[model samples]
Target: MIEEIPSEPVVITHIIHETPSIRTFEFSRRFEAQAGQFCMVWVPGVDEIPMAFSAGNAITVQKVGEATGALFSLTEGDVIGIKGPLGNGFSPEGRVLAVAGGVGAAPLRPLVTYGQADTFILGARTAEELLYAGELAGKAEDLRIATDDGTRGHHGFVTALLEEADPASYDTICVCGPEMMMKAVLGILDAHGVADRGQFSLHRYMKCGVGICGSCCFDSSGLRVCRDGPVFTGDVLLRSSEFGRYSRDAAGRRIPF
Candidate 1:
């Protein structure tokens, strides 16, 4: 039976080591999750963090810092608390272009899987970090990769890949990646003569998964990312000078990228 994610720990029935630094934790059963929404994961004794579901039963994680390191160390049958499908989600329409950087593919994978066939430009530091390429390929009409190390496909940023794409071919672009990368994406879109009709995910410091905490708001407009969106259109992004410029930290202090 489908289960509701709860505050209490739930068993991780299986695990898939996607790459050296990335792993997928599979829960006992499927839980509802929209393509762009996230789950608040509590790693007992370590810390709580937000994760995006790659599939109903699985959430992919990149072992970056302390909390993620503890998350990746989890073995089969280990229980961890999870609560979500929270936040606004992406909705695909017409023709779509999806770009993902490293583990950012975790969320976009579901979008391509459930939506109409689309194209993708997935980038990472190296070939090994280019996540879900094989899985995403099956769902994508065109699959391209940009690696910083030139170990795989194009030897440049994903924005370079975006630059080469005929912007007119697709109705819109959707991106999720580093703040700097998304900022570069905006510049590329402007140069390509594409209207700011695209959409992208904005990652901010989120404490409460709900809107109670004011941590994830735009600097000026006060639009809440956790509630109003984690995904916003290019038009919305254009209005906020803070879109790719800076993000608030745990204490709500602006940190420039």
Candidate 2:
């Protein structure tokens, strides 16, 4: 039976600096979440933000927004509230291909560590921004890197690498990255007549992690990223008019991507 796990306080027991801008905070509590699932992390006296589990008991955080900045300021033994294992996750089929960009690697890390990805393509702005590259290299059967600054492997966008890949070669192609990148990847998959095999994880503004707020709902289909999915199939996303066009801000204002 799927039972709801209530919000509870968790203590940070360890911290691993994954990148200059990203850190993984480990907690004592083991959250049994799948590769694509996320949790609502509450920073006391600050804000609650949705975070994907980077590991079994850790959240890889990039120092970005206010909530994340607050999380960065924290150290070992600091307490935080966690309320999830929420939403659906990727159920890896055969011969999975995983693609990630920037911090999007956090969620896909678990999948890679599970030995799910037969091939993994990772991209970031620079070499330093590539999260878990070393670990992922040891995990995935094949690992490729792309950097915008030419500090590492391919000197271009990750989508450039995706373009070289045969989408139909893999049974499932899971992607989590910047919206524009994912959109482009989706186009590639569609052109290859394998859109059904593509799974894209979306990043949307969310106040409440649950479906009640409706803040994360996109246009047309009105799918809630928090509830329905942070991970959506390429075909479903193609049907949504707002998927790549725009997203709502915290104030419900339409922000074009």
Candidate 3:
């Protein structure tokens, strides 16, 4: 029989800086976790935040707040509470294309490890802010990088790169990035008649990683992002006005669009 997994604190055994602002945390787990899923990271007396798994074996976290800042300060053997590898993750079944922007590339790293014919498009404002270049370069069949300031490979938005990409060559696409970038990508896919063929990871402030908090809701078919997603399809996001606009925190405070 499968042993019941307990919800408890796990010790952070390693931390690796990926970029100036992004870091990856390694946690000791008794079992393997699915790629693209996240865990509720509880920093004692501070706060708990939902962070997605970047590398499958290591729980990677981007330093975005006070709680996460504290997490980055940790060294090996430091402990933190963790509840899950909860929520849905991407199903990498066939030929795929992965698009990520800034720290958004963290979660897609694990997906790259599973053998597949995949291409990755990563975007950032500058070369210094980019993460996982070496990792992605080795895993993807084709790797493309874009920067907004013309400091990198392609001097344009990632959507511009998407526009130039041969979408018909891939069987599936996965996107994770700024809401506007994903929306732009969706538009590009739609124009190519491939909108229904891709998946997107929606980033939002989530508390109580479980559904009780009601903090991560979006208007797509009455979908609750915390429960139904942090990931959804282009088709679902397109129908929702709130997908790119409104978001809330644990206290139900409206986060500015």
Best by TM-score: 2
Output the TM-score of candidate 1.
0.92
Clashing pairs in 3: none
Per-candidate Cα lDDT values, in order, are: 0.81, 0.90, 0.76
Q: Which regions in candidate 2 have their CA more than 4 angstroms from the true location?
A: 1-5
Candidate 1: tens digits of C-alpha lDDT, residues 84-118? 77777777778888888888788888877786447
lDDT minimum window of 10 residues, candidate 2: 1-10
Candidate number achieving the greatest lDDT relative to the actual structure: 2
Q: For candidate 1, list the clashing residue pairs, or say none.
A: none
- lDDT, residue 8, candidate 3: 70
Predicted candidate 3 versus true structure: per-residue lDDT over 1-257, tens digit per residue: 22333457777777788888887777776435566777777888788888777754466666777997888788889888777777787766667888889878877887777754378899998987877887778777789999999887899888877777877566778888888788788888878888777788887778667776566777646676666877787777777877667676767776766
**Model 3 off-target regions past 4 Å?**
1-6
On the 0 to 100 scale, the lDDT of residue 87 in model 2 is 78
lDDT, candidate 2, 47-100, per-residue tens? 988999888799999998789999999999999999998878887899899999
Candidate with more favorable, higher TM-score: 2 or 3: 2
